[model samples]
Target: MQEAVIGLSHLFMTVFLCCFANFMVIPAITDVTMAALCPGKDKCSLAIYITGVQQAIIGLGSLVMPLVGKLSDTYGRKFMLTLPITFSIFPLVILAYSRTKWYFYAYYVLKTLIAMVTEGSVQFLALAYVADNVEESRRGSVFGIMSGFASSSFVFGNVSTRFLSTSATFQVAAAKSVIALLYMMVFLPESVVKYRTESTETDCLLEKPPTKTWKLFKTLPSVNDIICLLRTSPTFSKAAVVAFFSNMADVGLHASLMYYLKAQFHFNKDQFADLMIIVGIAGSISQITLTPILTPLIGDEKMLSTGLFFSCAHMIILSVAWAPWVPYAAAMISIVATFAQPCLRSIASKQTGPSEQGKAQGCITGICSFANIVSHLAFSPLTALFLSDNAPFRI
Candidate 1:
């Protein structure tokens, strides 16, 4: 029963709220609030500036995650895990009330700060729960089940946001987040053993003197060991690189794919929502159906590689902007990528010590966030250069 609870604890409805709120708002605002944020004569050019700012903020979060990891080590994990979710309230409130460029600036800065918190404690703590409670062999399956639940929210949230009024849509998301908070307060159980020692030597040493707080951070494997681990451990590097490039493809798509559809097909709110739903469906299916079947056959290493291959292929197809089945093809590629993500995380978990799960996951996610920042910075110019109306592809 405890195992079952631990497996399901991480999938609070609020996890969906955290991501869905951004998805529902960002794409729509790329033309509106983002334009206000930029306030230039050219709307698309303005969006580039907004993207740059957002990426800069996300990059800041990536920079701050190591600190959050250090805090998780010293202060405990639960509070840090809950901090970001509460911090999300500011942006949701701003989105509810704001109407001007200054509001956009204030809101963006605040949201960026809070968003950083999610990577270290917010995400890691839940996985840490699994690490504490679940046995070695079953970790992958538990993670898969969690991913499926978490990914399902994307499908529903996208579909709901498409039909709901702007205020109502954001309100529902806020409500979902509040409920997730309540659930965590009441039902989520912590499984980590406080003040654990790996062996008798540490136990005796603890009797002699307590270790300095800084020592915990310092005691982590040296830079050389990290390199050696990566060089010999194909699994970690494979998972990390796969995660990086797959996220890069996603950033490229999110940066311009909606605009592409709007330009090519005259898609409106409802249609855009439907297109997003398709992507979510494909992604959820990947996490739900594809990874389970493929992981066993291809193994985690090839699974990560295969996922990256399909995701990159999809991005290539999207960049071409051909007619007919472009959206569907892109959706299929994302599905495969989402399917493989858990496998990557599971493989990564297998390579690291149980005590360092929070730090390891934090590092992996930090790298992905860095990749996202780089892609966001690069994609704006790339899209402007390749897909802008003045360019050769004008159509």
Candidate 2:
């Protein structure tokens, strides 16, 4: 256990710092986007529209993740772990330096292309890491504990952004990514022992290794494997669909959240940070405690469904929130809803054999990617349209 924790320390620490950087980006991007796109307008709905475009790229970027995950299974987790963080530095630096819409557009396009290899995939990687290292019997509890630490990074990250300039924050994030890479290079060992052994066993069975690159390419999962992974397992498929809807709801909220609060309540960066801090604290606590306690009593499926119902409640409450504090109330009420992702991961990871954990997570990430495309196209524009003069939900 101690050795496993030591090996996973690098992975967990990197995830925390990356999440910190991500939370920092949330508040700054809205203002940067507004300044870049439409400086004169007080309520710049166009910023939301551009966010939609960026999310579309992120969604499309998810296509490569399954392949990356497969590559991790074949090669080792270190490369998949390192590559995304390495490539993401360019996009962060570009955002910090550039102000023009054209530059922003370039960043988004490049961000999409390199999405599989960045800090955004940290949670996905962490999930796989836990699946890889932990005993199957103890995975659920360990996953929750790990997720709690990861979620808590948002609190500190949000607070940090309140004091720093936007450029400084971005630079800090970029620097953190660099540090994460160094830590991984120096300390993180491979978490693919089972995958390596299983592959070796299979290779030993083969009389001779094939020469063609086309045949070599056959080592990774195909389109059929991606689809079949989702379709074949009832629990995994349900979790996938739930994750899809969960992300759809989440992206829709996120697409409009900052804008809505800023437009209605006149929330500045500090206020936005406060909201994130509240949610982050509540979520981190709940993430650590709730799933382990409930899973034994209700099992994974019941726990999942319960979390979804609470999540749906969260969305509905946020949609009709009449005052600024209402979002905070909704946050508190939905602490248990944070259980959804960990439970979903726990269930799916349990169903999958050890050797295929990467494929399972890749499939899950693929479903979320498709949802991002749909949510980006749907939610951001809808928020813009609603915030306009001729809409039904005028406040």
How many clashing pairs per prediction, in order? 1, 2
Model 2 agreement with the true structure over 49-104: per-residue lDDT tens digits: 77787778778877667776666665567767777767867878788786578887
- Taken over the whole model, the C-alpha lDDT of each candidate is 0.61, 0.73
Q: lDDT by residue for model 1 over 217-243, one digit each (tens)? A: 554434454455466556677777866
Error of 2 at 326 (Å): 1.4
Worst 10 residues of 1 by lDDT: 200-209
| Estimated TM-score for each candidate | 0.82, 0.89
Residue 127 of model 1: what lDDT?
60
Off by over 4 Å in 1: 1-7, 10-14, 20-23, 34-43, 73-75, 117-121, 193-234, 293-298, 387-389, 392-395
Top of the candidates by TM-score: 2
